[model samples]
Target: AHIITAVIGSGVLSLAWAIAQLGWAAGPAIMLLFALVIYYTSTLLAECYRSGDPETGKRHYTYMDAVRSYLPGTKVKLCGVIQYANLVGVAIGYTIAASISMRAVRRADCFHYHDVRGRSGKDSCKSSSNPYMIVFGVVQILFSQIPDFDQIWWLSIVAAVMSFTYSTIGLGLGIAQTVANGGIQGSLTGLSVGPGVTSMQKVWRSLQAFGNIAFAYSYSIILIEIQDTVKAPPPSEAKVMKKATGISVATTTVFYMLCGCMGYAAFGDAAPDNLLTGFGFYEPFWLLDVAN
Candidate 1:
């Protein structure tokens, strides 16, 4: 549950756009490469949960603890700064993503409601994300206040379920849209040097795509913390964590492939940066709202 909740984040929503940037050949290849790399590194990090032994040695309660245990002085501080900075960036990104989804839901309803009333373009349905961001912030604060959140067994489970819910919805919608398009879209080389995109822009976007795929598979920063929650000895915390990491990475990789490929097939080169909230499929507003 912890692995699932951590692995499948808002980063998955960008995969289609990433794929579009990299093209048919390089996209899936890079994704699989990232999956392999992440899984391997995660296992290594999982093994680092304990200082000297797999089963009995002193436990490193946190990532910083593990760093301090092995790489003594300055490296620990550097790791701490990098790790927390990444967390802060992730928080901001998620907040923005939540606000975008909220705005999308409202805009979807606005478009639908107007269409039903025989109105077209009368209202652009644009709205500020400030209120929505504030709402998400409040909700996050409430959740954070829960005592011993990491030990709350059901919290990760609920989060895992919600993550799967929206992910599956996005995948289903992508598949449906692809079928509706009558044929497969996209090329082996992806977006060509056309009128809108320059050669330099292609290079930049391709590099960004690598980062996007990497971001989707990144859960290593929390691997030690998750490992700390495992029950003792018999199987060993390292063993359990490795198993969990493998399963989670494999599961997420499958979902990422399906979502990314189907979305790219559905929208071709013009795939939006976000599959669900990017107005890729405006119809079935209720479903869009639910997914968001």
Candidate 2:
């Protein structure tokens, strides 16, 4: 549950756009490659949980501690700096995404009501997302005040459940949209270079897609902390961590593939930057709102 909570994030929403840039062939391949790489690295990190013995050894309580154990000296400091920096960036990105999703929910409802009233809603729906961002910030601050926030057992479970909820909704909606479009709607080579998109743009977007997919799979930074939460092992901590990592990676990859591929099939090169909030699957506005 902790692994799932850490691995499956808002970044999953951008996967359709990432796949669109890479096209049918390379997109899925790259996603699988990333999954393999992450799983292998996670297994290796699991082995590093204890210095000498697998069952009885000094425990590394955090990722930085693990680094200090294996790779001492200046490298540990550098690793700490980089890891925290990445985490800070991730926090900011998630906050922005949350705010946007909240705004999308309101906009979906607004459009619904306006259409019912026979009035143009597009003109009045324009509003800053600052208020939503502030609300998210305040909620996060409250959560941060909780002692040993990571060890709150129920927290990860709830997060994992919510992640699966929206992910499944996204996959279902993607399938529905694909069926409504009368067939699959993408190419083996992805977006073509021509009128609107130049060769340079395609190259950049493809490279961006690589980063997007990588970001979606990112969770190694918190692996050690998560592993610390597991009870002392009879089967061995490394073994248990490996098993958990595999399950989490497989589950998330299945959802990612379904959501990303089906969304691409539905919208082809025109896939939105976000599957739920990008206005691609607008009607069934209520469902979209719920997913967001």
Candidate 3:
């Protein structure tokens, strides 16, 4: 939940854009994928809980702890390396993906500020200004300045490597779910609700989504089933689990909404587009730059 949500909420700002790319027909399938992902995430989180609170001495089924508990050997060195590689790949991929969107926003803003002026209004860049979009802006500048020969060579190499990585089943499943199923507009659109748009409708959708993951509503049983097989916590633990689960998800969702809104509002499109120069993110803000 944390990783997938973090990446989509923080990494891929344009959850709306990605879902649109998948098409409306993709909704049910995408949702199935989300269910699977939730199961997987819950499995992981249940493990997190098994490991007694981080403050305490006892341990639960955390990935590393699980591995250490079950697979102790000289090959532990191998496990450590594999972990590092996984993290590095995540960082690089997130940086690259987010950077692309940032670059797009920057390009759009540059056009607005210099070519067309900031009259885009509703036609402004997409919402969901994730961190991936921000770094892409920087990539745009670097791509332009680097020597054409070596740069072209490296770009091809990177593309090929990334493709191979995604060829792995795990990567494909994880990426596909996050890109298409990560809800942005779904929390708003195509949802069942009372007729006409109303604040109450908005609140209902948000709560529906909250139930989908948190609150242990319809999803609780299936998720808790996976949890049982993994962590096997006592029934007495339900109260603590519920509290922790709610806090984690609520914080993440709020962070996402705020990140999306302020990022688009302040950096607007350029926040994603100008990531490469990183500085160009503010180029469209000539007035603010001067004021500062």
Q: What is the TM-score of each candidate against the true structure?
A: 0.97, 0.98, 0.37
Q: Model 3, 96-214: lDDT tens per residue? A: 55555354545545545654553545434444555555556577567668674432435434543432332222222223333454432332133334556566755654444333232
As for candidate 1, its clashing pairs are none
RMSD, candidate 1, Å: 1.1
| Per-residue lDDT of candidate 2, residues 172-237 (tens digit) | 888998998899989998999999999999999999999999999999989988898888979778
True-structure lDDT of candidate 3? 0.39
The per-residue C-alpha lDDT of model 2 at residue 198 equals 98
The lowest-lDDT stretch of 10 consecutive residues in candidate 3 is 2-11
Model 1: residues >4 Å from true position, as ranges? none
Which ranges of candidate 3 are over 4 A from the true structure?
A: 1-22, 39-41, 48-57, 60-62, 74-82, 116-243, 246-292
Tens-digit lDDT string for candidate 1 (1-292):
9999999998888899999998899999999999999999998998889877788899998999999988978898999999999999889989999999999999999999898998888368989999999999999999899888778889899999989988888899898999999988999999899899999999999999999999888789988988988999988999988898888999999999999999999999999999888989888999999889
Superposition TM-score, candidate 3 onto the true structure: 0.37
RMSD of each: 1.1, 1.0, 16.2
Error of 3 at 38 (Å): 2.6
